[model samples]
Target chain A: MSEEQNKQTLVAQETITAEVNSSDTIMDVFVRGARKGWKVAIDNIIPNVLMAYVCIKVLNVTGVLAWFGTAFAPVMAIWGLPGQAIMVILGALMSMGGAVGVAMSLFNDGTLNGTHISILMPAIYLLGSKIQYLGRLLGTAGVPGKHYPVLLGISFVNAAIAMFVMKIIAP
Target chain B: MEELKRKAVKVPISGYIALMIALVIFSGLMAKVGGGWTMLDFDTLNGKFGLMKSATASFMGQGGSGARDGFLFALSLAPGVMLALGLMEIVEHYGGLKAAQRLLTPILRPILGIPGICCVALVSSLQSTDAGAGMTKALRENKDITGNELLIFTAFQFTAGGIIGNYLASGSALFSYMTVPISVPLAVMLVMKLFGANMMRLYCKMFVQEEK
Candidate 1:
């Protein structure tokens, strides 16, 4: 072989050797790992899905929800959101996934329309985080010092501003 | 002596267990007063799909509507997930993240008024929420952080993703103009810069900022 061809052969050999060393039991290891990962995912998915179900489907707490909507009237006015907008924001505060669930519901019901969407998307984007869990989980586990209030407050305020802005530009 | 004591501290297992017990008791009492919990409306999945179909049809002829939906969906996740992957590729290829970190060192020190080394926690948090989880796991494993540091990081991490990856892809089209060559990343960073400064000021007032 010419020098160039010889160099190519050397490189190919190096590649084959690296592949062999890195993935010696590639199929077996990959299969076992995938099985283990799926097992954990399945285990965790049950409680989470169940809790989400309970919060959204079962909690027919419209009385409280209406209160939330009314309280958010000023905030809604900021974004020019209808009173109904607060319901979705309330949904989001409860759970981002849940709020998405609620927003999707409202949009489906024809409660949101037009440039109204652009206004709401930013709010949904902002106020909607997996935040409530942070309070329960982080306050319990984030750190030892009494910074929970500070952390939680900043996150909420940040999300709140995003939502308020969205309420403003909704046509 | 005070500094040494702070470095050596750990939450006693007994104390942590006691706290858990207290929480459980508190939760039980709250539950008893509040009654049972309920489910989310996720089973209304049909409604979600129906909305999508209708929105698509309504905005069918409208210019930029389809593009807006597609763009917003990607914007919501791209900065955190796709960008992280893109960054990993760049780091693997050019070894630039280290350089970036090194360049950021002088600014991170006084910018947030935290230790220069602690900037990695902030950066990692901005990139991915789970990445910050990994950082916390490492810190716990290594016993590197004190209780106070954990609180500080918790506050920081919760607020980190807002400016960077989270807001990068979604709704800034209004600001960026369609198909222009302007810098979206810079725009997102600027938002973070503005918000992050206010956030740090707010947090400092709420908690004691330890001087390094």
Candidate 2:
């Protein structure tokens, strides 16, 4: 009993020490976090969104976006999304922000709407950025190479399921 | 890795309060409230840009395309991203995440077939993909989890990896267009993540030959 009490006391002391060590005021902490947010916005969001717009422009100029909309229309109909929405899914595989960029571009051009955006939102993140994450996440975690396909498959399945759920829930 | 463990500090009551407030902010519930309460909402605080001569368009204007349009559009999104992350940071510093870790621990085994020890990595993964993956590697190297458990946890992190950060950051772009509240889709992502993890658990159980 005494040993347990001693351990508790040690833990209590450690907590107090941690509190003392973090001397920044609340406002300071908030600003520090906000700064990190600004960096992400500048570093990742802007460039990626810009790239997505350009890609969409190229696809638009080449008439590929129209072609894709016709080709994928049947498949995307399952999610109540237009055929061009496939581009958002494809973009998500590479980068989540980029997928958002595509979705935004499509929305701007009248190919999608508020409801379509709502449906695609969860699906975008559910399988978002898998190409980069295949190495950054799966490889780093040391999952056997053999199971990579299965992991990716599972994410795709999850994304598919999320779209169905979003379709039901989205207004 | 050890330092990440240090982050599992005792979550004070303030941490719980901070987390609740964070949820309320991101939940979009307060977005409709009148008066000063709007300050508590994300979109309300994000605010709108001053209109150009058209009155209908923001600074980006219309009939634009390609890189320049994308650049201006993305620039328009910058403030929302910054506000979201800044608030996320405040939540982290207040131990909201640690409190989340605490709340998530007990349900870990039931939900993901992983141990409570993984709660830290799970929460970390919700914020940053690299941090979660790095911690998972450490978890495996330390032999804190079995091979199958690692796969399941990785599967969870794999789908919807960095949920909060990615959603609040990039997903913020769609916030205005959504017919539902912001938190609804977030909830959907989280649910799908768990569902995906369980699928992995079943796969590991049925297919893989256990070495142990």
Candidate 3:
């Protein structure tokens, strides 16, 4: 390992040790974290679910999602996604793990498959680029600086390029 | 930012067109020029489209009801990650991370060429990529990050983890279909290297002031 990275690693190790010796026990840490996790999930998911409900109520009681699918189809088409995967993209982006729920739902209902999986790939890669407040916490916590605004742009372009190339190369 | 925005606005439209054309050419070549697959039935793209349409129609019909039963599959993992990270955060609050970063800050600054204060977003973005983008924006908003540094740091945030995770972990067929071939990690890393270097260079210009 490079000297710099090694130093960072050592520091991380020492910090953990020091923390354990303090008043907080490991169990205390875990409970706190779980509660925080639940909070983050509840906090983010509610707004999204509400938005989806509102969007569903206002946008297309009968075929709003289908229209959303169609609207996203061309964009998804660019990544080889069919129109139907739009909701899957939406589910995943609204909150963490929501997409997996969407995918699982589709899978059990005999909807998702290998081909659909392919179409969803680029969209997933492109999904949550706007994880807004999370980035600020990282900055405050001393994360490196070059990790936010541009990562999505670079990664998405790369993913788009990669996904397209894969489709072409495969068939 | 005003001047920089104005300069960015001046970039030629033709540049965008050229990029789009290149992408098309590359995609076409990928579609037709590949080997060891079904013997060149390009006209049957309609059949592929048809199959996708039928499958998707079925997928949307009752997918949501099934998903509610299985959301727990995801929750199982979130708790562990959150727990571990929370412990780490508590450790940080106690000043362990402060000592650690301080010890390593000098090297980090020279290598990443970023103010140490910006490292939080940079590192957070590294861990969770866009999960950290919000954090990055918050830092920017709080004025904890310098403008040029913010732009530069954001550029470095997604070398591979973001796209690859999206493609593989997010279970998005859209991403998989688009990315598995062009080498998402490679393309992203290349762009990151180039863009990040450029951002750093821009920040290092004679006019920019250092943080106090």
Q: Which stretch of 10 consecutive residues in model 3 chain B shows the poorest summed lDDT?
A: B41-50
Task: Compose the digit string of candidate 1's lDDT tens values, residues A18-41.
Answer: 122334343443344345333423
B175 Cα displacement, candidate 2 (Å): 0.5
Total clashes, candidate 3? 56
lDDT-wise, the better of 1 and 3 is 3
lDDT of 3 by residue, B1-212 (tens): 23211222232343344334333322333455556332222111212212235455322333343223333333333433343345434443344333433444465556566666554434334335544455555456557667656655655553333432232232322222332343343354434444444555464465455554
Model 3 misplaced stretches (Cα beyond 4 Å) = A1-21, A46-61, A67-75, A88-110, A114-171, B1-117, B124-146, B156-212
Question: Number of the top candidate by DockQ?
Answer: 2
Best by TM-score: 2
Evaluated with lDDT, which candidate comes out highest? 2
Q: What value does the lDDT take at residue B80 in candidate 2? A: 86
The candidates, ranked best first by TM-score, are 2, 1, 3
Write the residue-wise lDDT of candidate 2 on B1-212 in tens digits: 35545557578887799899999999988888888897889999999899977579888888888889888988888888888888877777777878988898899999889988888878878888877887777778778889999899999999989899999998888899999999999999898899999999999999988655
TM-score of chain A of 2: 0.87
Kindly provide the TM-score of model 1 when superposed on the true structure, using C-alpha atoms.
0.49
DockQ of each: 0.04, 0.43, 0.14
